[model samples]
Target: MSNNVPTGAEFKEQLRAGAPKMGLFLNSHSPTVAEQLAHSGYDWLLVDTQHGPMDHEKLSNMLCAIASGGAKSMVRVAGYHDRGGIQQALDLGADGVLVPYINTAEEARQAVSCTRYPTAGTRSVYFPQRSMNKAGLLGYAGNANKNVIVALQVETAACIENMAEIAAVPGVDMLFLGQNDLCMSMGLYEKYEFPHMYTSPELQAATETLISEARKNNVILGLFLFGTTRVAEFLAKGFSFISVGNDLHHVLTQSAAYVQDLEKIAATEGKLWTRRPTALF
Candidate 1:
């Protein structure tokens, strides 16, 4: 684990100062796929364990794949109670961790502690378990206390209600807004075509409060958007860290649009139907 490289926490400090922090989410388990994503100009890459079938072995492999392209690697554990996933992710060399469905300050506190060392927090340690080189492990633990980035996802209406306390948590690096779920929680399911959730007066006010409190407490603000165009709005709103899209959605969108365009072309060209072999994963 002793690659002796700069940690994401260090990079975050620099990114928070007007430089945009952009990252991608990995839904696939292929190491080569993860490596390709890392080289795609993403500042960081996060493996999604919440929805992906990523075991410790596969995760460790993918982490190495992500680092191969020099991208900061992160993992989104199932939740705070998934200590196995959390600890394994850190030991596997994730630069940071993202905990989802966080609705309370107490949960935020717990998530933060899970990533830290014994004295500062309670993360189990074992070298050579995942991070291949003992050098990488030693370096990771030596700086883990000051280097691990803990980002808590603030999505629920209740989370918005408790934003101040969540933002005030000492070790919390960023308060990430999960807009898709947040919109659903706010009774606006699948409403991206309508008013932007981040721009709504109510959500905007709550976000502003969270950002102000986070800044006051020396924490950073983050926002996740399903649309790339939404990045500009978040940037204008003073968000430094952002996640735009994921592999599955990107692939599905492009495939769907291409098929639709081909179908229209066939209809106009007098082709009664199109035929192709179907492959299912």
Candidate 2:
């Protein structure tokens, strides 16, 4: 580990201390891109496996690449109940795991349990794992519980209703708000359109509920912003852990800008061409 890179425990401490830690989502599955983004001054990088294509081998390699750039690595495992996925990410040297769709305290407990070993929780130990290799057998076993972060996604109406209990879960370090899913759950997505859905009165109330409960429980609050546009706004609202955007989004947006610029230049030169529709994937 690089001296500049904070350990998982340190990263958690930073968040708890109210530092605005910014990060980007790695959906590209390419370690090269992951490493580049890690070096781009973000405090951390999340390897998104829930919607991104990444197998165990690819995940491990991406984690290694992110580490090489001296930034903390977090893996968003495929599901909240995926004990194996959680363990695999931690064992492969990821600083933390983001478990999605945790709707209740019991589910939150289960997610935390998967991150711990033995008496603390139910995580199975493997001596030859990357975690053990990095920290040594005894060192890894002794500190894994404290060093690993357990972040749960709060994206459903049920989770909002049970926010108090979910935030009070012993080992739950952070509650990450998945805005798109939350909007869908609140029926704002179907009722309204694109940006308007995000600003609905119902969604705003739910967000306030989340903030209040998180502050009341002394847990860190995280959010996934669509882009860098609303970063300052969310940070002002006490969201410290924020992912500005993802790799693919940046690629598409930048590529579209370049193409548009070329079209403008061609038009000035008396050249005309049909424009294809842009896909925002």
Candidate 3:
């Protein structure tokens, strides 16, 4: 048994206490953006490492930035990577992890395995990861199981096909949808905001099925949204864990708005502020 200071992870406790939480994605290379979002009172932050340019080195600094903001951190890791990445993410003091491209229950099991110590999973035992406070390991192993949130993605036809079993995985805490990816897989890529998406009887049935399966198995249903546009719709559909917009998206959105506002002001004052992008939005 090791005696040292323990890491305090707050997200899992909020989850267990039946609180619904919201957060934003952090993909900017700038650590200050992460710190700013953290201080914005977001319940959590996802350091996106899957499809974005943010790497481990940058993520490390972002995690440190997040610490000061007092928000929990999660890493959305690429599915192609394996245990090594998962271990590294945990060691970096992330409160949890969300793995992408989970297409089966076995895949869900694999994701959960990497989050725990031996007997519970195959994650290598090492007390020296940054998760420990200055004091040391301090019962990290003993508390990890309860503190970490192991969430798996269910965003493909096959995953939805096996949603029931995946939801039943013993240690799985949440199932999130890669909404954009899932839409693409169904050949409905940009139709998410259109009426056809819901009018299609087949798609509607599948969504209802997924929600039923998650609730039946006692797992939280999560959705990563592109913006606040559909947050209300998703919540009405029963999403307990919600997130909207990445750092980059937020910047692009606000910057475009600022330019538009400036242009309008120039028009009112009879000066030309004509630098609007053709595709701003």
Candidate 4:
């Protein structure tokens, strides 16, 4: 009778305290990878269903795998207006949900509604699933709507324009911007370095706008980060959440750099294994 439920208390605590929480996107869709990350000490893990290959079945497996980890489980459902995945994710025990392309207050409200049941929202109940522990279904319904975090992505110009309105949405817990897509929207297609990419006028303006709106509404602001390089900078500006990178990205980036460095040393010494390899991981 092991039941996995999403208690959004931690996310709420950090959001209110203004302390930063580093989340990672689980794009691998492998339960083993998800289990490995559970031990990595991340604050949260997002199963990227939007751009990744996690169907409902795999997403459910991931949610269960990540439950044992220290990080909270979140699902980035496929479409902005998808109640199917939203309801499915909530039912599968996601701590929160990240709805993409939230361009207006209405979409934000709908996203929140899908997470709730009849009287409060449009989420239908087919419980006794993994989230209920087969025991707490009645009690779970009582507090889920308020406890489950609902983070909306403000990625487009329309969303930025309606930032104030979106922030005012009752059930919307956090606001995030994927900087890469955001830059593409603003036509700033240059490959800027990490931390420095956020310094551009367009990105800076977007950050300022989110900051202002967040202050007025008491909402949390989020950004996508490559690593810990710019954490202090964004945290100083009142951001509470950041995704450090996906599982695949982390392993590949570190391993590739390690290999390249080894090649450099080998070239200088005229031997491939002249010395012991430095432990990068």
Question: lDDT winner among the candidates?
Answer: 2
**What ranking of all candidate models by lDDT puts the best one first?**
2, 4, 1, 3
In model 2, what are the clashing residue pairs, if there are any? none
> How do the residues 1-281 of candidate 2 rate in per-residue lDDT, one tens digit apiece?
35867777888888888898988898988999998888888989999999899999999999999988888889999777898899889989998999998899999999999998889899998888887886698998899898998899989999999998999988888999999999988888789978898878898899999999999887899999877888888888899999988989888888878888888988999999546874652
TM-score of each: 0.86, 0.95, 0.89, 0.89
Superposed model 1: Cα runs more than 4 Å off: 1-6, 130-138, 190-199, 260-281
What does the lDDT read for residue 30 in candidate 3? 78
lDDT of 4 by residue, 1-281 (tens): 12332357655866768877788998887999998898888878999999898789888889988987756888998656898899889889888889998888998898888887778888887758777773488877877777788889878877888898999988778888787777767666665655465678878898789889978888888877777787888889988888888888898788777877887888898886533454644
Best by TM-score: 2
Q: After superposition, how far is residue 117 of candidate 4 from its true place, in Å?
A: 2.2
- Rank by TM-score, highest first: 2, 3, 4, 1
- lDDT of each model, Cα atoms only? 0.79, 0.89, 0.77, 0.81
Predicted structure 4: lDDT: 0.81
Lowest lDDT 10-residue stretch of candidate 2: 272-281
lDDT of 2 at 56: 96
Candidate 2 ranges beyond 4 A from true positions: none
The backbone clash count of each candidate, in order, is 7, 0, 1, 0
Local error of candidate 1 at residue 106 (angstroms): 1.7
